[model samples]
Target chain A: MAKTLTQEFTKGLWEEIAPFRLVLGLCPVLGVTTTVENGIGMGLATTFVLVFSNLLVASLRNIIPSKVRIACFIIIIATFVVVTELLMQAFAYTLFLKLGVFIPLIVVNCIVLGRAEAFASKNSITLSIADGLGIGIGFTLSLAALGSLRELFGANNLTIWTTPTSVIGVQEVFGPHFQPFSFMVQAPGAFVCLGLMLCIMNLLGSK
Target chain B: MRELIKMVIVLTVLAVLSGGLLSGFRNATAARIEVQQLKFVKGPAITAILKGVSNDPIEDRFAIKDGETERKVFVGKFDDKANTVVLESFGKGYGGDIGLMVAINMEDDTIVGAAVTTHSETPGLGARAKGDPGFVSQFKSLSINDSFKVTADGGRVNAMSGATITSRAVCAAATEAGGIYQRMKPQLIEKLKEFNK
Candidate 1:
């Protein structure tokens, strides 16, 4: 059976979700998802880079030689990453500061390059855009969910963005009486949370 | 072979195009990026330390040559007099350099307040250098000549639990800020004089 264009798009959301299902871009998923806002911001930034890179790669697929394709792909992807970095610095400097090296590290994010190589390089531009959107939204939602979980359990707060008086940008998810399970915000917690989520996903997928 | 030449041409064109697009975008957004950085990341820290300043320290800033790099010094005016200036300092931390900002009351050469700006310390441990305000608040109202060391090192300041190294680094940065203020006193004072005119 021939897969339709919509399949290429929709599949990224659940079946081939980048962070959970595909496990393609787990670096930002773990690193930036400490707060819901950081996760959403990182996700959107990665999506911007992914969409443009995919579109450009697919459009230039014919002209790019097989021998130099990887090099070409890197340059294209890096260009978008820089664009994302500058835009984030200009508009979202707080998030940019919070994200730090991870923003520049997006140049090496396997998801953008993977899509360019595996999907975009061979697919049509329209299809590539759809794939980018689907995958980007999936990655974003996954990050937000993961971040919300961590923020809820780890700090007893869900910090979406800084409010005027709050200064620290956190909304108490539970009452002040709740003692935060701080471990959920650390490295081990990231692995455990992601692992548990993956297990749950597998259980659902198997059924 | 002709294939080699074709590959070279393709790569060169791609590089040039990518380079051109990036440079163009960077040039367009450079000013806005700087303003955003000052407004968001550094502004809060500056204001936090210079709590009573009437003027916008982010805007009332000047740069001076510090070694090979130009260091930006923000001026905080109280009662319309630029008698205080905030400057940044760096000290070696467990992971790397810990950046801190110290606001100095030029009159008595005392620290108004200090805040950690950046660090690469462990998140839940050493990162308290930035996260815990009480750690930095220890420097408030202290004379610049006072040794800014952790209590473990026989100084008045207390180190964060399990983050003694980071605490020491922050104290070192405050001490560095004092040194910078002393060295740059003449210039900073002169600059502040002009601001009042």
Candidate 2:
């Protein structure tokens, strides 16, 4: 029943990936994956909040009353979310604009609260940190994968990152002749893509 | 009993700590955030409206006191004369307030150009106000004193199809800009004189 630090971390990458495996925190996973840049930005923001909140909640687990634990967790989570929002606005203003409401909405991300409740509250600080990092990186990888898939088929471009002056990505990824499946970038496309990914994840796990 | 006291203490301490941390971070990052907003959000719109100006509209800016509120005005220099000013105003839209930056020529009192700075309107419909230039272009060369209204309200400007509210919000903002420009003209002239020399 005991998970070593390595196991705690690795599980998040595959066995308990937030979006694909655990199926938690789909709001951002579905919303901000329009571009790989967006996905990475959202994932990192969530990761920052997750790691800090987990650290704080685990450290304070002894002091937090069972009746008021959820409230305490939210306060800690919300503070970090705001910090992420401010930092993003100050530094990555364009990404901040693209992500918009989702950054503030990170406070309500089930993954953060879920980890705080189920894992961090009962684990050692080192274990909790490993879990946070593992899950955070897993979420980031999942988002980037989805974003690249969607961006490639939908926009026919893979926007890895956007700088103030230039975009660092492939243009006309399918050699300009291939028509973009524009639907893959729409709201409905997000659902279909996510569903297909979930199915593929299930198929891969079964073996 | 003791459990209730513990809950209160725990919740209070957590809440207070979170508040203090957030406020400190906010204070530290507030100035940088403003610069970022100017560079990304408001800068493009200001540049678009002040096209062909001899000076950087974003750099040559001044704040004017209107009653209690101080409004930042961007100055545009055309052919060596600082005769145009852009003022930002907001109009209530269906989703939220839409920010409009309206530029006015001081000599003729006509609108030079107008652009949307910030908005939260519905995409592809209300959001077209920012994306598509056709709707905002109607304000070009029009006198600032003229009351702006869409066809539905019996004004000259035509509203974008399926976005009447957003169009009206933009019109309202332009009209509000006129009011502010007129009210601040004397002080604006004084400020423009400083820029001219």
Candidate 3:
């Protein structure tokens, strides 16, 4: 009567994307993605929170009373988010500032809560962890794919993961002196990138 | 009754755990956080100024005091050049109080570095005054006695398109800071020795 772990992992790629398919956590997906670097940072942090929270909620489902389950889920999620925020501030201060409030806002991301309510509440602990992993990876890939395209076209460079040190002798190739395109780093560019990515994703899924 | 008691106990435990975690983090990283903050605020801009110059801003401080104003303004000497001082000023812009930190030379009030630390400015346009080279570079080497104005007002700097109000506000703040420095040169010089000690 129980579903296999492989099905749990595969479901996240198309059936429940946490963004395009489930239509969850869209605010941050668009907010912090001015550049591919910020997008990837945000994506990985969010995936970490989602996986951990999902696993925690599933493990505690039976112990918590149904009447207060919603409140319990929120505390667990918030605890993990606080940990993520502290780690970013300590180790990734630059990215932490660039991503700003979106990092802390992970507590409210519907993806985590939705998983808790829909699958974690009823699924086996092992299956719940699998679901979390599948969904987290799918979300991270989607973000990186969207971010790379935005950075390449909007800024005319592939700056997703390179540090400043990597550019020591490479400035001439990137630009005479690379000027990040102001337009692409602003809010309107978010919509442009999301729309183009959405269209491509739809086309690929259909064919 | 028993369920209610358990609920209170659970909520209390959760709150304590979260608070303790936050406080522990704050204590452990306070010094490193302060150092990072100081570097982020002034390091890059000051370094950019000293790149081709002989002096470093951190080593030297400016000593200036004007007899008339009675208020002293000390410009820190770096590598023996009196070129940079921490400035405090704010303007009521279209957004809100825009507080700034500016570093300028005592001899000429030529800005060594400038940063707007607080502003609720228009996202893309007004905020560009910080990121846009055309805007930031305008303040460099500008004589304190010289007018701070947008090119439209017969100055050298261009007005940020769609952001003329914010642009003027920035210029006004810069001018005020410059005038105060000149007015208090005598007292500022004397105070630098005291403050530095």
For every prediction, compared with the true complex, DockQ reads 0.68, 0.83, 0.22
Per-residue lDDT of candidate 3, residues A40-135 (tens digit) = 788889878878878888887776667777888888888888888777766666777677668878888888888888888888788988898888
Q: What is the TM-score of chain B in candidate 1?
A: 0.81
Q: Compose the digit string of candidate 3's lDDT tens values, residues B48-135.
A: 5445445444444443434443222224556654445656456666777665556667656577655565466777878776567576
**DockQ of candidate model 2:** 0.83
Scored by TM-score, the top model is: 2
The model with the greater TM-score, 1 or 3, is 1
- In terms of docking quality, model 1 is medium
Task: Write model 1 residue lDDT over A141-164, tens digit each, in one string.
Answer: 999999999989998887777633
lDDT of 1 at A94: 72
lDDT, residue B170, candidate 1: 90
Report model 3's TM-score to 2 decimal places.
Answer: 0.65
**lDDT of model 3, residue B18:** 68
Task: Write out the backbone clash pairs for model 2.
Answer: none
The local lDDT score (0 to 100) that residue B130 gets in candidate 1 is: 82
Better of 2 and 3 by TM-score: 2
Question: Which candidate leads the pack in DockQ?
Answer: 2
Candidate 2: residue B167 Cα off by (Å): 6.1
